[model samples]
Target: MAENPAYPVGLRLTGRKVVVLGGGQVAQRRLPALIAAGADILLVSPEATPSVEAMADAGEITWHRRPYAEGDLADAWYALIATGDTEANTRASAEAERHRVWCVRSDDADAATAWTPATGHSEGVTVAVLTTEARGRDPRHTAAIRDAVVEGLRDGTLVAPHHRTRTPGVALVGGGPGDPDLITVRGRRLLAEADVVIADRLGPRDLLAELPPHVEVIDAAKIPYGRFMAQEAINNALIEHAKQGKSVVRLKGGDPYVFGRGMEELNALAEAGIPCTVVPGISSSISVPGAAGIPVTHRGVAHEFTVVSGHVAPDDERSLVDWASLAKLTGTLVILMGVDKIGKIAETLVAHGKPADTPVALVQEGTTAAQRRVDATLATVGETVRTQEVKPPAVIVIGEVVGVGPRTSA
Candidate 1:
């Protein structure tokens, strides 16, 4: 057991030389962080994972295709010994010690002078957990703590917030179903950094309360009926706010592109010559059904699934849905924003050759505490919707795939 304790400090390795003596699993795990820190990486190994090879091909790092040798860390600021060969790792660490460079041994941390802490990053804060227990420094234990802090920051529990240079741009972030935890890690980070948040009614509304006082929260579906506003006005609001040198977040439910008008916003911002980024969220069309114990596509049950907007009635001339064709697909049919038109939609599907007995599931406000799943057949779904008073934003799954999985928590 290595009884000697080590001091913890953040290394400023940006543009500094770092030597990595392996390109396998351990190297793959540690390389991205070093590359992200802008280190001048020199990778020594005979073979590497496809991802590391791709990185090398992209000129992100310099690859030395050979075994590790003494004096490898002569001019390196930091060194990592990750080879499978014990002798090679020992030699590399000894050379790092000789050259006054702290070496991290992947196979045996006790033999190395430095230990890599379990690390995570969120909202510009990097949480690193290190175990001081020399006899039993379980990396898993340290990583659990790191994950908790990072998750808390992500879900707005750990509110260590900051402003990052006031980037005057738009971030089209998909808020994911109704669950605050379902949002993507990058989306959550950008949400924390937003100066203004333009939110939709169907979006994860719970997260809005977590925003700081300085952040301007605009409701697109409130008293003003902002979602009904001319899209030009919406575009102008985004442009105007960004022009003021504030980071703007246009938060929408599920994927911004899945009938959320995200591309229009992207185009408007692009035409205005403003920088923008799109962080995708989990689409409710799939997640909601799953949350309700309905698999949109089950192996040996449903090979294909089609997602359609039910907001427009089938009789409407503007509606382009091929109800006749949709009726023909033996696979699953996922309808979003279709609760109001479910009766009409189901009538059309059944009339157009879809079986009246096809299993149907309507999941309302899925992935939330208020989530409710109602099971019915195509022939009875319309009646069930009326009886249950199921409203908009519910995911209607039509197919045998709905019953493929043992019913979740009803």
Candidate 2:
């Protein structure tokens, strides 16, 4: 800490004038937070980086498109003098001082009246860390401290017993393809705070191991065409736990709504008068194929990509997908939960006039260490899956895009 330690505070600049005297890297970095704070920004610079220009173009800020001129800080509540030009920055700093506006100088931290801290957010809490120039003003060190605090808060390792407000409800959290790290921060935070976690066989399974020993972890065990917990039973579990004043998290793979039967749970919870929060995850339909180096849609090669659930065979009366129409389309096709019925699906597509030579790739247990990709043509995919012993939770990608990038065949 310096002899004159800085007093930290958060400014609510909503609808207040904030003058930014440069559009360089520093200004580019600082403008977003100011904008998010709902500051009425005025940017003065002869030229700006493309990103800053985009903000101005989007009408988020007013860009003068000229060098910093005197009187620019006349009515500003705060000023950021970041124009790399030394003389211009000095002039602007002097003007800000005369106007008594809080100013941050990118060139000279000691000369500025205010300093920006390395800031991060977790749940509804904001973590900001500041260091003095005498302490070397290492932004990276400050950021590292900020990140550690935020991560601890999000993972429940850090807690304020007095500030804790537990809301008892069901949160439909999509754990993302298979990687624990891929889950959204909000989803992870909710899991950290959960008292009861009813999880599926899919999604980020590793996250379950991280939950506190006191948490009740129920295995929904929803395996396709296998021993599984009934949907109704799962709903009852969520309702029962939440009714007991416990925060329940229904952890599912991919997006809860993307064929995960999330709406059914929401409807059930609604009838039971329970609150539910849906946290969208990275769907295996797109991400799994991507993890295997397969793009769902490639420019000129594929104009569109369709995601379809193939749990039911194409010949099954219960099947709602139009196999014939799907076969006629020239875009890419991504099939989830179709490993067991891939043979019939391939046959139906070929019978409906899809090319037999269309490239196909199956990504199994994608985004995890056990992930593997097997490549084949549309005609050979059925047989390939059998010989390769591909399992459930595989994403089947079909079209020229499967062959677009460097192949990642197992």
- Name the best candidate (by lDDT): 2
- Residues 182-283, candidate 1, lDDT per residue (tens digit)? 998778878887889988888898888888898899886542435556566777888989999988999999999999999999998999999999989999
* Candidate no. 1 TM-score: 0.76
Task: Please report, in order, the local distance difference test score of every candidate based on alpha carbons.
Answer: 0.88, 0.89
| Candidate 2 structure quality by residue, lDDT tens digits, 1-410 | 24688889999999999999989999899999999999999999999999999999999999999998888998999999898799999988988889899999888888888998999987677999999553468888899999999888876566433255667899999999999988988888888878889898896889999887888988886423234358877888889899998989999999999999999999999999999999898888888888889989889999999999999999999999999999999999999989999999999999999999998889999999899999988899999999999998799999999888986646
Please give the range of 10 consecutive residues that has the lowest summed lDDT in model 2.
Answer: 221-230
Candidate 1 Cα outliers beyond 4 Å, as residue runs: 1-115, 120-142, 149-164, 223-230
Error of 2 at 369 (Å): 1.3
On the 0 to 100 scale, the lDDT of residue 249 in model 2 is 95
Name the Cα RMSD for model 2: 4.5
